[model samples]
Target: MPRLLIAEDDADLGPAMKRALELDGYVVDLFARGDDVLVAVGVGSYDVILLDIGLPHMTGLEVLRALRARRDETPVIVITAFDRTPHRVAGLDAGADDYVVKPVDLEELAARIRSQLRRRERRHDDSLSVGRVTLDFAGHVASMDGEEVLLTAKEFRVLALLMRRSRRFVSKTDLEGELYDQDQWVESNTIEVAISSLRRKFGRDFIRTARGLGYMVGGLEA
Candidate 1:
């Protein structure tokens, strides 16, 4: 299930939005403060973020700017009561993937989320290969040394992220967000388990660890 983080300050509207999105099958988290929204994004994984402009402590626009400043590409949709041209332009210019004016239609919100997710999926849809191991994402299959390899669902997701990012390090927190939903009870060592399993199948050098930082695809010997 897709996870969503909603930062809305209105007492009544926040809860109403949460319940509505939950009913649409999204695992939702609500934050009434803008700073809290930033904190949640740093520690939690969410497929899409709904940010309301009128937030306490910090405006949603400020929050969006901070997120983009860090190069975080998570899709964000700005939700606000301001439907004026300047507000819409400012939100888009500040890195919001989409914007919605208030009195939000839940159905429309859901559709927009789906569209962003689809676009994200397309970004990483290509088949990938490193050394003798090859991953066919379209077919949902993998092969190493000319033989088929079977991987658990979680394993595939880990491999896919690593492959797509290649040399770039993917932090544990980021990987966790992508691999599991917020509502799921995940063990602390869940990511470690997946990494260990991948190494066992593809060899240790297939993934390199940066001590306290994260994991990345290292140069695989041909």
Candidate 2:
């Protein structure tokens, strides 16, 4: 599942958007203040951010500028009631990847999110190859040694993250965040179970574990 952050101060609209996006198969974290958004982005990773311009404590443009100053390239779509030309220009100039006016159409918002994702993915190859294993992100398929490997949705997501960060350990906590949303109930051994299942299909040594550091792929010895 893709992770998203929503910064909207409207008490009702915030939750409504969160729920709707969640229904669209995204793990969403909602914040009502710009300061809180900064805090969240500092510690958590998100594929996209939906920002409201008039947020409390700090304006969305301020947050956007701060992120750009630090070179945080995560895609952001500014959402505000002000649809004036200057407002839109200011947002684009501040490094917003896209902009949307208030009273957003849910379907259009979803499409915009997808577009951002596709654009980001294009920054890298459509597929990843590590040893004999290959993951075709565009086709949503995995294969090993020219043979197709079956994977459930959760399993595929877990594998994608690990393969993308190949040669680097991905902590279990990070995997959990990628696999499930806050509202979902996750088993203590959910990651372990998935890892074990993947090893069964891909070969026992395909993935390696680092006691406290977590798991990784592309560590196969020659």
| Winning model by TM-score | 1
User: Which residue pairs collide, candidate 2?
Assistant: none
lDDT of 2 at 178: 88
Instruction: Tell me the TM-score of each prediction against the true structure.
Output: 0.62, 0.61
What do the candidate models score in CA lDDT, each in turn?
0.84, 0.87
lDDT of 1 by residue, 1-222 (tens): 888999999999899999988998889999999999888876555778999999999999999998877556678999999989999999999999999988998889889999998987775576666556778888899899779899988888888887766545799988888777543766789899999999999888888888777998733222
Whole-structure CA lDDT of model 2: 0.87
The TM-score that candidate 1 achieves is 0.62
For candidate 2, lDDT tens digit of each residue in 94-115? 9999999989888999999999
